[model samples]
Target: MSEILARLAAVEEENRQLRQEVEALRRDHADHRETVGREIASDRRRITALETPAPALREKTAEDHVNRLFSEMRRLNIRQTTAKDAARLLGVSKPLIDKLKPYLATDPRFLILRDPHHKQRHLIRLAGT
Candidate 1:
């Protein structure tokens, strides 16, 4: 029947238009997903940068270890075999000796202070035996 054919053709045209709209929506969704992914990557890089602390903290920690051990050795009145004594023991800068002397107070066998009046001193002292 002619009426049946017209109805079928109208349905097919509507189906085709719906398919095109669905394809457009899919492309839009894909583009949005790409944009969101890029934003996530950029935010991740920013978070990583902010989470990381930039400092010579490790070197400073080494310095503190050297200071603590040097003071402990001095407080215990241990004899030094070499300038390398504290340097070798703490695995830190042997040159720290020169830098630390102004703060170094001693009684021949005693190390009196490892104070960095200009900086916060990280001191760990061992009780004398």
Candidate 2:
């Protein structure tokens, strides 16, 4: 009966060691999961930054929209139109049409004139059109 008691003590010690090992493994897995989550968050922020355009690039895109509006006007043979009308026809925002005012004023191929009937309105027209 002494040998049986010794064998039981050995088995209990082995079980305790195995429990400690399992707890250690669980802790390691939790740490790894936290590290991976942080990495994923950092990568998402990097991707968002890469996707956003700088202010200068955004202005360039708006200018491209203005150029497209000009092409559309020419194609449609529109001699004159209001800024609001142009915005509607081009499927762009009104602010973009407002931004085009300076370019149109300086292009020489186009003209900007005040609307006689509306004090706060203006007209854009192709030269000689």
- Candidates in order, TM-scores: namely 0.46, 0.51
Worst lDDT 10-window in candidate 2: 54-63
Model 2 C-alpha lDDT per residue in residues 1-129, reported as the tens digit of each score:
999999999999999999999999999999999999999999999999999874442556656766776788899989889999989988877877787788778777678999999999999988877
Candidate 2 yields a Cα-based lDDT of 0.85
Structural RMSD, model 2? 6.4
Candidate 2 local lDDT, residue 81 = 91
lDDT for predicted candidate 1 compared with the true structure: 0.60
Predicted model with the maximum lDDT: 2
lDDT of 1 by residue, 1-129 (tens): 999999999999999999999999999999999999999999999999999965533555545655676576776676432335655665556566544433443323234334454253432233342
RMSD of each: 10.3, 6.4
- Candidate 1 stretches greater than 4 Å from native: 57-129
22 in model 1: Cα distance from truth in Å?
0.4
